[model samples]
Target: MNRIKTDWTKPQKLSLVALLFIIGKTIKESWVLILYFIVRAFVKQNEDEDDTEKRSDKLIYFLLLTAAFLIFFQIQKFIQFFKTRIYIKDNELIEQTGIFTKKTKTIPIHKIQSVHLVQNYIHRFTDTCTMKVETAGTEKTELELSAIDYLKAQDLQEILQQKEAVSAANISDNNSTQLMGLSNFDLIKLAISENHIRTLSLIFAFAMSRLDDLRQFFGKKTDAIIDEQVNQINFTTSIVAGMIGLGIAITLAFSVIRVLLRYNDMQLTANQKGFKVKWGFLQTQQKMMLQNKVQLISWNSNFVRKLLGIKILRFFMVGENILKDDQYIKLPVLQEDVLKKLSAYYQPVWPSLNENPNYTHPSYAWRVTMIYILPVAFAASVALYFWEPWVMIIPILLFLYFLVTFKIRHMKFIFWYNQTSLQIQKGIWGDEHILLNFKKVQHVALETSPFLRRKNLATLVLHTAGDSIKIPYIPLTKAQAIADRCLYEIELDKS
Candidate 1:
């Protein structure tokens, strides 16, 4: 095996990629100032004035000011890059940073929750990656090496993983087991089945935001430009249909391209220590998660994926929420057998819905309708009456939609628990399953409102390190018993 001969104990500077990273960071951080300068130079200019010399002088002054501002920031970042140093010693990761004011941070090795290696296009070209270290209880990345050697980053991550294993007292052998990998055909299938409507909505939202920005610059003239463009378009039924088809085609193409780039060459593996997922085409990312640190495991499938026999599996480690889709660890389960095998590794005994499962109270449907649908219906009735009475039909349709769906939603909801774990089955058209270990429950609470109290029902909430699960509108006695059992299991785990 080939190994790099760099000592991690001694302080070391970042890779040369840091120069590019620093430049990019400076530009991103100063974008608002850049925008302000551009707006001032354009909006404040007196184009109608005949005094050419005065305008020339003003332009020169603006150029010099912008140049000086950018130069100052560049110098500051350069100095910061030179001064920053990092090293691992005495079971702690230490970093020293800052140009004028010095600051240092130390994180214990055992406290690290995960180590992520990210390689964007620039880093890929330079054969480097960013190393992000996250510790338990921190809301954000605790330490980041903006640029480091890709191979060295993996070695350092393994070292940290070993330290975590020792702390947990559950070290395993050096054999890695491959859990999942995607082929080119599988990637095509995955891309084809993705929700293209969501992608189209995102694209439409971005276009609208850009239009608002244009409105700020052009004032009322922006609307004039839009109207002029619309007038120029020869809108026939065929043309309108062609445009809609073209838009759909473009959205699907974009989605396919995006999925291919982001999830190309994906692999998931597990060992005694933990799980590691590697994926990407241009910008590769590797996520390492410890076995014992994973607090919640969930698998959700939409209508399309359900037909394809696929589901997206997510692992929620300590201190992680619903982060950027790319940041959190997720895998596409292609088969039920694969999902069962992976589930067995994380949770030995996956609970099934009982023949007579604990369903929500009979009032669940009506209560959900009153809480969610009534307010919107009432607001729409008031607003639409003053605007367009005909539009009131929309709110009526929406109310009926929710009223029917909530009844099916309540029927679909099931909560099952055993001595060791809790299983929640939820959703209307699609199936979503969540598994939580009793030991992972950090807090349990029983909640009731006047309505619930009158019906002898309460809501039980179980809070874990990464996520929370709520069993709403259950019998008060059952809710209390569930809470007490969770607390007892947590205390037993401590012993």
Candidate 2:
């Protein structure tokens, strides 16, 4: 396949921002015009004469505004023509641009961590996409190829994947497997257990609610019409109409339908080689994740999903911000059971679960309540003596709430270590479970506060390849021993 290149026009790239400016100006001006007309119509005498003159003046102002916009558009096009040409080579990508001074950047392929293809509404309609390539070696060395043909984006992805495979092969790791398509059973489990229908319903509702805002910004000037309609409804009638039982039912039904339509033939497959994700309704996207580049795995679930035994799994590659939160890849809908089974295939060296009876820390709730309630109680008692005696009851009630909330949510924190791995667990609800291999650990630190030192206790912090894990409130000697052992393990692995 031919490699990808991007040559974006200035006006094409800045069209969205231009539209935003126009919409903002139009709204402000229209509001002023409305107030002027209202004053002329109701507050002033000889309203007919003023209204006719104001209408003619408004037409002239609009014509002048259009001419100014056209002048700005021409200037933008001229700047774009001077600064636009990006080229991608077999092992390097380069961007060349300049108005007065030329600038060029060449990025090596080996350093790249991930490649992404993104499309907005306009891009989708125009059959174009933007490609972003990120590297691991440097922080600011990002390559953006904008306004490329959709096929060019896919071709670019494939090129990067092949380059990475060759680089891995050069390093002598032969384990590689192409991802197989997701099974029908797996999809059904993902749909039901992950609450895909519910999630889709929420997305649809959120999108629909934004319609009014979107119309205000993007549609013609119609604020007065909308406001008039809104004001016409009686308060009692509006309250009755606001009953959302029917809306909820419709949302749920439509959400399930949307999920089915969107993921009609969804598939996810991965092996030691790389991961492949393919799905869509109107526009399809294919994402690749090299196995060796995988950095972290995280799982989350809300209260309802937890009750239903569902969890969402996300994977972070070494450097890619695949999602807004910096996650590299995610399985949006996956049953906990299905995820467990899939983990074995994707993560062959999954860390072993560690069980430790001796390791424990105070619950977060206990800490939060104790931190807040103690001071409040002391202050309230002193105030009660000088002020209203009822002040004592206020503090008492606050302390009671704190105590109850802490007791209900506080749970034992545990950290465990085995020959090859370390595990940390905490939280009463939505428990966080972290597993890290010993080899992945970069360093270890032992910390002790004045209180901890007085109690003969300290905290052990484990710094891994990607992130850090801490086990707080352990015996001081034990914490020191753990830190030393981890440091020794790191040295041993390197040796």
Q: Name model 1 segments beyond 4 Å from true.
A: 4-6, 24-73, 98-102, 210-222, 232-234, 353-356, 370-390
Name the regions of candidate 2 deviating beyond 4 angstroms: 1-90, 119-127, 137-141, 165-266, 279-284, 319-323, 326-328, 332-358, 362-368, 377-412, 464-466, 485-495
**lDDT by residue (tens digit), candidate 2, 294-338:** 555556665555665655566655554343543354454445455
User: How far is 465's C-alpha from truth in model 2 (Å)?
Assistant: 6.3
Candidate 1: lDDT of 445?
Answer: 90
Error of 1 at 440 (Å): 0.7
Clashes by residue pair, model 2: 177-273, 179-270
Candidate lDDT (C-alpha), each: 0.84, 0.60
- 201-274: candidate 1 lDDT, tens digit per residue: 98899999999999999898999999999999999999999999999898989888878887788898888788
Clash count per candidate: 0, 2
Provide the lDDT at 342 for model 2: 50
